[model samples]
Target: MESVITGLILLLVLLVFISEIYKIRFERKNESQDERGQFLIFKVKSLSYTILSAGIFIGFALVAILKVMKPEIFIYYMIIVYLFQSVASSIYLSIVRKI
Candidate 1:
C-alpha cells in the first residue's frame, strides 16, 4: 500500500516534469540551438536506455538466481532505476550543455 502511494506520488511528479519539458521544447526560446538540444535529448535517451537495460538485466538475474521473491523488491528496484536514470540524464545534459 505504501509502495503504491509512493509510486502514485512519483508518477504525478514525473508527469509535471514531462509537461514542463514539453513546454520548453515547443516554446522556441532556443530556436537557434535546436541541434544542441536535439543532441542532448538523443544522448540522454541513449544513456537512459542503456541504464534501463542493465538494470532490468540485473533485476532479472537477482530473481532468477538469488531467489528474490518479494514483489516489493522489484517495485523498489524499478523506482531506484528510474531515479538513477533521471539523475544520470540530468548530469549528462548539464555537462554537455556546459561544453
Candidate 2:
C-alpha cells in the first residue's frame, strides 16, 4: 500500500517535470541561439542526463536486491546511492559541456 502510494506520487512529480521542460523549451525556441547550437547543446545535455538516469535505475535495482535480504538498511542504502549518483551526474554534465 505504501509503495503504491509512493509510486503514484513519483509519477505525478515526473509528469510535472516533463511538462515544465516542454514549456521552457517552447518558450526559448525562438529567443534562444540558432537551431544548430540549440540542438548540439541539448544533445550533449541529454547524454549526461541519460547517464545519470541509468545510475538512478541501478540504484533502484540495488535497493530491490537488498530489500530481500536486509530490509532495515534499504532506505539508508538508497539515499547514499542516490546522493552519489546526483554528484556524479553534475560532474558528468560539466564534462559533457567541455566536450
Off by over 4 Å in 1: 1-33, 68-71
TM-score (C-alpha) between model 1 and the true structure: 0.63
How well is each residue in 1-99 modelled by candidate 1, as lDDT tens digits? 999988976885675476446435533557325986767778867988999899888887787777765656887787677666766666666576678
Q: Estimate each model's TM-score.
A: 0.63, 0.39
Question: RMSD in Å for candidate 2, one decimal?
Answer: 8.2
Model 1: ten consecutive residues of lowest lDDT = 23-32
Give Cα distance to truth, residue 55, candidate 2, Å.
Answer: 5.9
lDDT of 2 by residue, 14-97 (tens): 654654564356446663367754665576457556765775576566667644435576565555444444444344434543
Q: How many backbone clashes does candidate 2 have?
A: 0
Clashing pairs in 1: none
lDDT score for residue 47 of model 2: 56
RMSD of 1: 4.5
